[model samples]
Target: MLKTLPADSRPREKLLARGAAALSDTELLALLLRTGTRERGVLQMADEVLQRFGGIAGLLHTEPTALKAVSGLGGTAKRAELLAVMELARRAAAQQLKEREVFSSPDAVKRFLQLHLAHKAHEVFCVLFLDAQNRLVEMRELFHGTLTQTSVYPREVVKQALALHAASVVLAHNHPSGTVQPSRADEALTQTLKSALALIDVRVLDHVIVAPGDALSMAEKGLL
Candidate 1:
Protein backbone atom coordinates (compact mmCIF):
# COMPACT_ATOMS: atom_id res chain seq x y z
CA MET A 1 0.00 0.00 0.00
CA LEU A 2 2.84 2.41 0.82
CA LYS A 3 4.47 1.65 -2.52
CA THR A 4 1.25 2.46 -4.33
CA LEU A 5 0.96 5.91 -2.74
CA PRO A 6 1.74 8.94 -4.94
CA ALA A 7 5.50 9.56 -4.96
CA ASP A 8 5.08 13.08 -3.64
CA SER A 9 3.20 11.68 -0.62
CA ARG A 10 5.88 9.12 0.25
CA PRO A 11 8.16 9.76 3.20
CA ARG A 12 11.38 10.35 1.27
CA GLU A 13 9.79 12.34 -1.47
CA LYS A 14 7.72 14.37 0.95
CA LEU A 15 10.85 15.13 2.96
CA LEU A 16 12.58 16.33 -0.17
CA ALA A 17 9.64 18.44 -1.25
CA ARG A 18 8.76 20.02 2.08
CA GLY A 19 12.02 19.80 4.04
CA ALA A 20 12.75 17.57 7.06
CA ALA A 21 11.08 19.91 9.54
CA ALA A 22 7.81 19.41 7.76
CA LEU A 23 7.83 15.65 8.29
CA SER A 24 6.21 13.98 11.28
CA ASP A 25 8.12 11.61 13.54
CA THR A 26 6.52 8.62 11.85
CA GLU A 27 7.43 9.90 8.43
CA LEU A 28 11.02 10.64 9.44
CA LEU A 29 11.31 7.18 10.99
CA ALA A 30 9.87 5.58 7.88
CA LEU A 31 12.68 7.15 5.87
CA LEU A 32 15.22 5.68 8.26
CA LEU A 33 13.70 2.19 8.34
CA ARG A 34 13.47 2.29 4.51
CA THR A 35 11.16 -0.70 4.15
CA GLY A 36 8.45 -2.58 6.04
CA THR A 37 7.79 -6.26 6.55
CA ARG A 38 5.20 -8.27 4.64
CA GLU A 39 2.74 -7.81 7.49
CA ARG A 40 3.01 -4.03 7.89
CA GLY A 41 3.85 -0.82 6.05
CA VAL A 42 6.91 1.25 7.01
CA LEU A 43 4.70 4.05 8.28
CA GLN A 44 2.78 1.57 10.44
CA MET A 45 6.03 0.07 11.71
CA ALA A 46 7.34 3.51 12.64
CA ASP A 47 4.15 4.28 14.54
CA GLU A 48 4.51 0.99 16.41
CA VAL A 49 8.09 1.86 17.33
CA LEU A 50 7.04 5.26 18.70
CA GLN A 51 4.20 3.64 20.70
CA ARG A 52 6.40 0.88 22.13
CA PHE A 53 9.29 3.15 23.03
CA GLY A 54 7.14 6.03 24.41
CA GLY A 55 8.64 8.62 22.00
CA ILE A 56 11.93 9.62 20.34
CA ALA A 57 13.80 10.38 23.55
CA GLY A 58 12.68 7.08 25.06
CA LEU A 59 13.95 5.24 21.99
CA LEU A 60 17.26 7.11 22.14
CA HIS A 61 17.63 6.20 25.84
CA THR A 62 16.93 2.50 25.24
CA GLU A 63 19.95 0.24 25.15
CA PRO A 64 20.83 -1.29 21.81
CA THR A 65 20.57 -4.78 23.28
CA ALA A 66 17.11 -3.97 24.61
CA LEU A 67 15.94 -2.86 21.16
CA LYS A 68 16.35 -6.42 19.93
CA ALA A 69 13.14 -7.19 21.75
CA VAL A 70 11.16 -4.52 19.90
CA SER A 71 8.82 -6.24 17.42
CA GLY A 72 9.70 -4.73 14.05
CA LEU A 73 13.12 -3.33 14.91
CA GLY A 74 14.64 -6.71 15.77
CA GLY A 75 17.92 -7.02 13.88
CA THR A 76 21.26 -6.03 15.33
CA ALA A 77 21.89 -3.90 12.25
CA LYS A 78 18.77 -1.85 12.88
CA ARG A 79 19.71 -1.38 16.51
CA ALA A 80 23.21 -0.37 15.48
CA GLU A 81 21.75 2.14 13.07
CA LEU A 82 19.67 3.66 15.83
CA LEU A 83 22.69 3.86 18.10
CA ALA A 84 24.69 5.53 15.36
CA VAL A 85 21.96 8.08 14.84
CA MET A 86 21.94 8.90 18.52
CA GLU A 87 25.71 9.21 18.60
CA LEU A 88 25.61 11.60 15.68
CA ALA A 89 23.05 13.72 17.50
CA ARG A 90 25.18 13.76 20.66
CA ARG A 91 28.28 14.72 18.73
CA ALA A 92 26.42 17.47 16.95
CA ALA A 93 25.26 18.88 20.27
CA ALA A 94 28.78 18.71 21.65
CA GLN A 95 30.11 20.49 18.60
CA GLN A 96 27.53 23.21 19.01
CA LEU A 97 28.54 23.63 22.65
CA LYS A 98 32.19 23.87 21.66
CA GLU A 99 31.49 26.63 19.16
CA ARG A 100 29.38 28.90 21.37
CA GLU A 101 30.39 31.05 24.33
CA VAL A 102 28.94 29.42 27.39
CA PHE A 103 26.26 31.30 29.42
CA SER A 104 25.79 33.70 26.51
CA SER A 105 23.70 31.04 24.79
CA PRO A 106 21.94 29.53 27.75
CA ASP A 107 19.67 27.42 25.61
CA ALA A 108 22.63 25.76 23.92
CA VAL A 109 24.04 24.77 27.28
CA LYS A 110 20.62 23.48 28.30
CA ARG A 111 20.39 21.47 25.09
CA PHE A 112 23.79 19.89 25.71
CA LEU A 113 22.82 19.05 29.29
CA GLN A 114 19.44 17.64 28.27
CA LEU A 115 21.08 15.34 25.73
CA HIS A 116 23.54 14.12 28.33
CA LEU A 117 21.42 13.91 31.48
CA ALA A 118 17.74 13.79 30.71
CA HIS A 119 16.11 10.35 30.45
CA LYS A 120 18.99 8.75 32.33
CA ALA A 121 17.85 6.06 34.77
CA HIS A 122 20.43 6.95 37.41
CA GLU A 123 21.73 10.18 38.89
CA VAL A 124 24.83 11.82 37.39
CA PHE A 125 26.85 14.79 38.55
CA CYS A 126 28.42 16.75 35.72
CA VAL A 127 30.50 19.88 35.41
CA LEU A 128 31.28 22.26 32.59
CA PHE A 129 34.55 24.09 32.96
CA LEU A 130 34.97 27.52 31.44
CA ASP A 131 37.65 30.13 30.87
CA ALA A 132 37.54 33.70 32.28
CA GLN A 133 35.23 34.78 29.47
CA ASN A 134 32.90 31.80 29.94
CA ARG A 135 33.86 29.95 26.78
CA LEU A 136 33.58 26.21 27.44
CA VAL A 137 36.83 24.49 28.27
CA GLU A 138 35.49 21.01 28.88
CA MET A 139 32.63 18.94 30.24
CA ARG A 140 32.94 15.96 32.51
CA GLU A 141 30.75 13.41 34.25
CA LEU A 142 32.35 13.45 37.67
CA PHE A 143 30.14 11.03 39.63
CA HIS A 144 27.30 8.59 39.35
CA GLY A 145 24.74 7.54 41.92
CA THR A 146 21.54 5.57 42.31
CA LEU A 147 18.03 6.64 41.44
CA THR A 148 17.78 9.43 44.03
CA GLN A 149 21.26 10.51 45.07
CA THR A 150 24.81 11.06 43.88
CA SER A 151 28.02 11.73 45.78
CA VAL A 152 29.87 14.87 44.72
CA TYR A 153 33.34 15.73 45.97
CA PRO A 154 34.08 19.43 46.05
CA ARG A 155 37.80 18.73 46.25
CA GLU A 156 37.81 16.58 43.15
CA VAL A 157 35.79 19.19 41.29
CA VAL A 158 38.23 21.90 42.33
CA LYS A 159 41.16 19.72 41.33
CA GLN A 160 39.72 19.31 37.87
CA ALA A 161 39.06 23.01 37.61
CA LEU A 162 42.68 23.79 38.44
CA ALA A 163 43.98 21.27 35.95
CA LEU A 164 41.79 22.69 33.22
CA HIS A 165 42.81 26.24 34.14
CA ALA A 166 39.14 27.08 34.24
CA ALA A 167 38.18 30.37 35.83
CA SER A 168 34.57 29.32 36.29
CA VAL A 169 32.27 26.30 36.21
CA VAL A 170 28.67 25.27 35.75
CA LEU A 171 27.34 22.34 37.74
CA ALA A 172 24.53 20.02 36.71
CA HIS A 173 22.86 16.80 37.79
CA ASN A 174 19.81 14.82 36.88
CA HIS A 175 16.86 13.71 38.97
CA PRO A 176 15.62 10.43 37.55
CA SER A 177 12.32 10.92 39.33
CA GLY A 178 11.52 13.65 36.77
CA THR A 179 11.42 16.62 39.14
CA VAL A 180 13.62 19.68 38.71
CA GLN A 181 13.23 20.67 42.37
CA PRO A 182 16.56 20.84 44.18
CA SER A 183 16.73 19.22 47.60
CA ARG A 184 18.41 20.83 50.59
CA ALA A 185 21.36 18.59 49.92
CA ASP A 186 21.59 20.05 46.43
CA GLU A 187 21.58 23.58 47.81
CA ALA A 188 24.21 22.71 50.42
CA LEU A 189 26.40 21.04 47.87
CA THR A 190 26.23 24.07 45.59
CA GLN A 191 27.42 26.30 48.40
CA THR A 192 30.18 23.89 49.28
CA LEU A 193 31.36 23.77 45.66
CA LYS A 194 31.12 27.52 45.35
CA SER A 195 33.26 28.05 48.43
CA ALA A 196 35.83 25.47 47.39
CA LEU A 197 36.19 26.82 43.86
CA ALA A 198 36.34 30.36 45.15
CA LEU A 199 39.60 29.49 46.94
CA ILE A 200 41.28 29.20 43.52
CA ASP A 201 39.56 32.29 42.05
CA VAL A 202 37.09 30.07 40.21
CA ARG A 203 33.43 31.01 40.19
CA VAL A 204 30.35 28.84 40.29
CA LEU A 205 27.93 30.18 37.76
CA ASP A 206 25.00 27.82 38.16
CA HIS A 207 23.79 24.45 39.33
CA VAL A 208 21.20 23.07 36.95
CA ILE A 209 18.90 20.23 37.90
CA VAL A 210 17.76 18.21 34.95
CA ALA A 211 14.47 16.35 35.00
CA PRO A 212 13.02 14.13 32.32
CA GLY A 213 11.17 17.02 30.72
CA ASP A 214 13.06 20.17 31.77
CA ALA A 215 15.90 21.73 33.79
CA LEU A 216 15.99 24.38 36.52
CA SER A 217 18.76 26.80 37.44
CA MET A 218 19.76 27.11 41.09
CA ALA A 219 21.54 30.43 40.55
CA GLU A 220 18.42 31.88 38.96
CA LYS A 221 16.50 30.76 42.05
CA GLY A 222 19.14 32.40 44.34
CA LEU A 223 20.23 29.00 45.64
CA LEU A 224 23.80 29.47 44.48
Candidate 2:
Protein backbone atom coordinates (compact mmCIF):
# COMPACT_ATOMS: atom_id res chain seq x y z
CA MET A 1 0.00 0.00 0.00
CA LEU A 2 2.79 2.43 0.91
CA LYS A 3 4.83 1.66 -2.21
CA THR A 4 1.66 1.99 -4.30
CA LEU A 5 1.48 5.60 -3.22
CA PRO A 6 3.60 8.10 -5.18
CA ALA A 7 7.34 7.66 -4.56
CA ASP A 8 7.34 11.25 -3.27
CA SER A 9 4.77 10.07 -0.70
CA ARG A 10 7.35 7.81 0.94
CA PRO A 11 8.69 8.94 4.35
CA ARG A 12 12.35 8.73 3.32
CA GLU A 13 11.84 10.77 0.18
CA LYS A 14 9.75 13.33 2.00
CA LEU A 15 12.46 13.63 4.62
CA LEU A 16 15.11 14.08 1.95
CA ALA A 17 13.05 16.76 0.21
CA ARG A 18 11.86 18.73 3.23
CA GLY A 19 14.55 17.81 5.75
CA ALA A 20 14.12 15.51 8.79
CA ALA A 21 12.36 18.11 10.97
CA ALA A 22 9.26 17.97 8.78
CA LEU A 23 8.77 14.23 9.29
CA SER A 24 6.47 12.80 11.93
CA ASP A 25 7.85 10.53 14.64
CA THR A 26 6.74 7.46 12.74
CA GLU A 27 8.17 8.81 9.51
CA LEU A 28 11.53 9.49 11.16
CA LEU A 29 11.56 6.03 12.65
CA ALA A 30 10.53 4.54 9.32
CA LEU A 31 13.77 5.79 7.83
CA LEU A 32 15.62 3.89 10.55
CA LEU A 33 13.35 0.81 10.89
CA ARG A 34 13.95 0.34 7.15
CA THR A 35 12.05 -2.93 6.47
CA GLY A 36 9.02 -5.01 7.30
CA THR A 37 7.17 -8.28 6.50
CA ARG A 38 6.23 -9.07 2.86
CA GLU A 39 2.98 -7.14 2.65
CA ARG A 40 3.83 -3.86 4.43
CA GLY A 41 6.73 -1.59 3.65
CA VAL A 42 8.92 -0.26 6.47
CA LEU A 43 7.07 3.11 6.69
CA GLN A 44 3.73 1.53 7.44
CA MET A 45 5.38 -0.91 9.81
CA ALA A 46 7.14 1.93 11.59
CA ASP A 47 3.85 3.79 11.94
CA GLU A 48 2.11 0.79 13.43
CA VAL A 49 4.94 0.16 15.85
CA LEU A 50 5.05 3.81 16.98
CA GLN A 51 1.31 3.75 17.56
CA ARG A 52 1.66 0.65 19.70
CA PHE A 53 4.52 2.11 21.68
CA GLY A 54 2.67 5.47 22.07
CA GLY A 55 5.35 7.98 20.95
CA ILE A 56 9.06 8.55 20.29
CA ALA A 57 10.11 8.90 23.92
CA GLY A 58 7.85 6.01 24.78
CA LEU A 59 9.55 3.93 22.11
CA LEU A 60 12.92 4.99 23.47
CA HIS A 61 12.01 3.87 26.98
CA THR A 62 10.40 0.58 25.99
CA GLU A 63 11.99 -2.82 26.43
CA PRO A 64 13.26 -4.75 23.40
CA THR A 65 10.60 -7.46 23.71
CA ALA A 66 7.86 -4.84 23.88
CA LEU A 67 9.01 -3.39 20.57
CA LYS A 68 9.59 -6.82 19.02
CA ALA A 69 6.07 -7.96 19.82
CA VAL A 70 4.75 -5.42 17.31
CA SER A 71 3.79 -7.41 14.17
CA GLY A 72 6.11 -5.95 11.55
CA LEU A 73 8.95 -4.94 13.89
CA GLY A 74 10.90 -8.00 15.00
CA GLY A 75 14.60 -8.38 15.71
CA THR A 76 15.87 -6.27 12.85
CA ALA A 77 13.65 -3.26 13.31
CA LYS A 78 13.98 -3.26 17.09
CA ARG A 79 17.77 -3.45 17.06
CA ALA A 80 18.10 -0.94 14.28
CA GLU A 81 15.88 1.62 16.00
CA LEU A 82 17.53 1.09 19.37
CA LEU A 83 21.03 1.30 17.92
CA ALA A 84 20.11 4.44 16.03
CA VAL A 85 18.89 6.18 19.17
CA MET A 86 21.99 5.15 21.09
CA GLU A 87 24.24 6.31 18.30
CA LEU A 88 22.52 9.69 18.13
CA ALA A 89 22.91 10.05 21.87
CA ARG A 90 26.59 9.11 21.60
CA ARG A 91 27.19 11.71 18.94
CA ALA A 92 25.52 14.38 21.06
CA ALA A 93 27.73 13.43 23.99
CA ALA A 94 30.85 13.38 21.83
CA GLN A 95 30.09 16.94 20.76
CA GLN A 96 30.03 18.10 24.35
CA LEU A 97 33.10 16.07 25.28
CA LYS A 98 35.18 17.74 22.58
CA GLU A 99 34.20 21.35 23.36
CA ARG A 100 34.14 21.47 27.15
CA GLU A 101 36.63 21.28 29.97
CA VAL A 102 35.79 18.42 32.29
CA PHE A 103 36.66 20.12 35.58
CA SER A 104 35.30 23.60 34.83
CA SER A 105 32.07 22.99 36.66
CA PRO A 106 29.83 20.21 37.93
CA ASP A 107 27.05 21.20 35.56
CA ALA A 108 29.23 20.49 32.54
CA VAL A 109 29.87 16.96 33.72
CA LYS A 110 26.18 16.42 34.48
CA ARG A 111 25.12 17.68 31.06
CA PHE A 112 27.65 15.50 29.27
CA LEU A 113 27.08 12.21 31.11
CA GLN A 114 23.32 12.61 31.39
CA LEU A 115 23.05 11.98 27.66
CA HIS A 116 24.91 8.67 27.73
CA LEU A 117 24.63 7.14 31.20
CA ALA A 118 21.29 8.48 32.39
CA HIS A 119 19.27 5.62 30.90
CA LYS A 120 21.56 2.76 31.78
CA ALA A 121 19.91 -0.28 33.39
CA HIS A 122 22.57 -1.37 35.87
CA GLU A 123 24.81 0.92 37.90
CA VAL A 124 27.74 2.46 36.03
CA PHE A 125 30.40 4.22 38.12
CA CYS A 126 32.43 6.51 35.89
CA VAL A 127 35.22 8.85 36.91
CA LEU A 128 36.50 11.98 35.21
CA PHE A 129 40.03 12.98 36.14
CA LEU A 130 40.87 16.55 35.23
CA ASP A 131 44.15 18.42 34.98
CA ALA A 132 45.37 21.74 36.44
CA GLN A 133 43.95 23.89 33.63
CA ASN A 134 40.73 21.83 33.81
CA ARG A 135 41.22 20.25 30.39
CA LEU A 136 40.18 16.70 29.58
CA VAL A 137 42.46 14.19 31.23
CA GLU A 138 40.89 10.75 31.26
CA MET A 139 37.69 8.97 32.17
CA ARG A 140 37.51 5.44 33.51
CA GLU A 141 34.83 3.06 34.65
CA LEU A 142 35.87 1.96 38.09
CA PHE A 143 33.04 -0.58 38.36
CA HIS A 144 29.66 -1.85 37.23
CA GLY A 145 27.34 -3.44 39.74
CA THR A 146 23.83 -4.49 40.84
CA LEU A 147 21.12 -2.05 41.94
CA THR A 148 22.11 -1.77 45.59
CA GLN A 149 25.88 -1.65 45.41
CA THR A 150 28.93 -0.91 43.30
CA SER A 151 32.45 -2.13 44.06
CA VAL A 152 33.97 1.38 43.85
CA TYR A 153 36.50 1.65 46.62
CA PRO A 154 37.70 5.18 47.29
CA ARG A 155 41.28 4.17 47.98
CA GLU A 156 41.72 2.90 44.45
CA VAL A 157 39.81 5.85 43.07
CA VAL A 158 41.98 8.36 44.92
CA LYS A 159 45.12 6.45 43.94
CA GLN A 160 44.21 6.67 40.28
CA ALA A 161 43.23 10.34 40.56
CA LEU A 162 46.52 11.16 42.25
CA ALA A 163 48.49 9.19 39.69
CA LEU A 164 46.95 11.37 37.02
CA HIS A 165 47.74 14.38 39.25
CA ALA A 166 44.21 15.54 38.61
CA ALA A 167 43.16 18.93 39.95
CA SER A 168 39.54 17.89 40.42
CA VAL A 169 37.12 15.07 39.72
CA VAL A 170 33.47 14.42 39.12
CA LEU A 171 31.74 11.22 40.09
CA ALA A 172 28.84 9.97 38.00
CA HIS A 173 26.51 6.99 38.23
CA ASN A 174 23.11 5.93 36.95
CA HIS A 175 19.84 4.66 38.41
CA PRO A 176 18.28 2.01 36.20
CA SER A 177 14.73 2.67 37.36
CA GLY A 178 14.77 6.28 36.06
CA THR A 179 14.42 8.06 39.37
CA VAL A 180 16.89 10.92 39.77
CA GLN A 181 16.49 11.11 43.54
CA PRO A 182 19.62 10.03 45.28
CA SER A 183 19.35 6.96 47.45
CA ARG A 184 20.75 6.81 51.02
CA ALA A 185 23.42 4.51 49.64
CA ASP A 186 24.21 7.05 46.95
CA GLU A 187 24.63 9.77 49.55
CA ALA A 188 26.88 7.67 51.79
CA LEU A 189 28.96 6.52 48.86
CA THR A 190 29.49 10.08 47.68
CA GLN A 191 30.52 11.14 51.17
CA THR A 192 33.03 8.32 51.35
CA LEU A 193 34.45 9.07 47.94
CA LYS A 194 34.64 12.76 48.70
CA SER A 195 36.45 12.22 51.98
CA ALA A 196 38.99 9.84 50.48
CA LEU A 197 39.77 12.00 47.49
CA ALA A 198 40.11 15.02 49.80
CA LEU A 199 43.31 13.73 51.39
CA ILE A 200 44.98 13.80 47.99
CA ASP A 201 43.79 17.40 47.44
CA VAL A 202 41.68 16.33 44.48
CA ARG A 203 38.46 18.27 44.71
CA VAL A 204 35.23 16.32 44.25
CA LEU A 205 33.47 18.89 42.12
CA ASP A 206 30.21 16.96 42.08
CA HIS A 207 28.54 13.62 42.45
CA VAL A 208 26.01 13.26 39.66
CA ILE A 209 23.36 10.54 39.82
CA VAL A 210 21.56 10.17 36.53
CA ALA A 211 18.29 8.50 35.67
CA PRO A 212 16.38 8.32 32.42
CA GLY A 213 15.44 11.90 31.43
CA ASP A 214 16.47 13.27 34.82
CA ALA A 215 19.36 13.67 37.21
CA LEU A 216 20.30 14.71 40.78
CA SER A 217 23.37 16.62 41.88
CA MET A 218 24.82 16.12 45.33
CA ALA A 219 26.15 19.66 45.36
CA GLU A 220 22.90 21.23 44.17
CA LYS A 221 20.87 19.19 46.64
CA GLY A 222 23.23 20.08 49.52
CA LEU A 223 24.36 16.49 49.91
CA LEU A 224 27.89 17.63 49.07
lDDT of each: 0.85, 0.74
Residues 109-154 of candidate 2: C-alpha lDDT, one tens digit per residue: 6666766676556788998787776665777778899876678888
Pairs of residues clashing in candidate 2: none
**lDDT of the structure predicted as candidate 1:** 0.85
> Highest lDDT among the candidates is held by which one?
1
lDDT of 1 by residue, 114-214 (tens): 77888678999999998877888889999999997899999999999999999899999999998999999999999999999999999999999987657
- List residue ranges in candidate 2 displaced over 4 A: 6-9, 38-41, 47-85, 102-111, 133-135
The root-mean-square deviation over C-alpha atoms between each candidate and the true structure, in angstroms, is 1.8, 3.6
Error of 1 at 217 (Å): 1.5
Colliding pairs, model 1: none
